[model samples]
Target: MRVFIGYVSLSGNTEKMAVNIKNRMMAVGCEVYMERLDTVEVDTLKDFDLSFIGLYTWDQEELPYEANEFYEELVQADPQGVKVALFGAGDWSQPRPCGAIDIVSNKMKSCGFAVYDRVLKIDQEAPAPDRIRQCEDFADRALSWGSKRKKWRFFIWNRMQNNPKYQRTAYLLRRALDDYPIK
Candidate 1:
């Protein structure tokens, strides 16, 4: 599957988690595009079949400026057919841990993306083995979801045309999805 991973990290914690997720995805043989929020072209999100969004929660659970900007662009974009997954790093000791996950997840849902079931959180640093295992499980689930005929119905097929990188099987599935009904 084609996957996009975008994240913002001030302390390097979020970036670390993002990398872990990317590596795990790669290990599973999924094609992945990873970028930092400061450098990523938000419009590119529409091109991927699945996306993993990561960020760090700032003081009072607010978004860092770069993350806030990306979040706004993501909200404005037409991401209806993409499957999304969220991960974040924050002070778990705080009353609320990784609030950015909730914020970003809600925004993505508002834009009509199908969010993955799990939202990963790190207390203050990169993932340990347990956390890495969580991401692996998420990767497995995402791969399975990407392959399902029912999940493809959400994609906007016209947008997928002309992409040579799309595998033949994926292309055919998208074509089929275009004709499939929502309900």
Candidate 2:
């Protein structure tokens, strides 16, 4: 499956987590596209079968500046039907640790992305063995979701292609499906 990972990291904590997520997904035979949140276009979300968003919590439980912008753009980008998973890095000792992950996950849900509840939160800037395992588990679940969605899409496409009236719609859907083929 095709996956996209967009993340923001001020001190590389979130970046490290993002890399771990990428590696895990790649290990599962997924085609992953990793990009910094500041550089990624929100509209590109539609091109992937699954998405992982990672960020660090800023002051007052707010999203980091770049991630805040990315959130706004995501809300306006029509992300309906996209599959999403969230992760964040922060000091648990802080009053509001990993708050950005909650914020992004909720917003993505509100925008119609099929967001899962298994969010990964890392304490401090270091990765533990448990955290790495969590990342792998997260990848496995995301891959499973993508696989199911692909099957459903194929079912719908097959049905539509059988009806002459929906041939045009089926063709366009086929193109979109081509961009994110299931493995």
Identify the leading candidate in terms of lDDT. Answer: 2
The local distance difference test score of model 1 is 0.76
Tens-digit per-residue lDDT, 114-138, candidate 2: 8977888889745568678877887
Off by over 4 Å in 1: 125-127, 150-183
Using TM-score as the measure, the top candidate is 2
Model 1 steric clash pairs? none
RMSD of 1: 7.7
**lDDT, model 2:** 0.81
Per-candidate Cα lDDT values, in order, are 0.76, 0.81
lDDT of 1 at 116: 76
Residues 1-183 of candidate 1: C-alpha lDDT, one tens digit per residue: 688998899878778778878998787556889988778766777788788888889888788888767777775777767777888888968888888789888887877878876788878844488667766777667666655565443333332443466567566775687876344
The residue-level lDDT of candidate 1 at 32 comes to 89
Off by more than 4 A, model 2: 125-127, 149-183
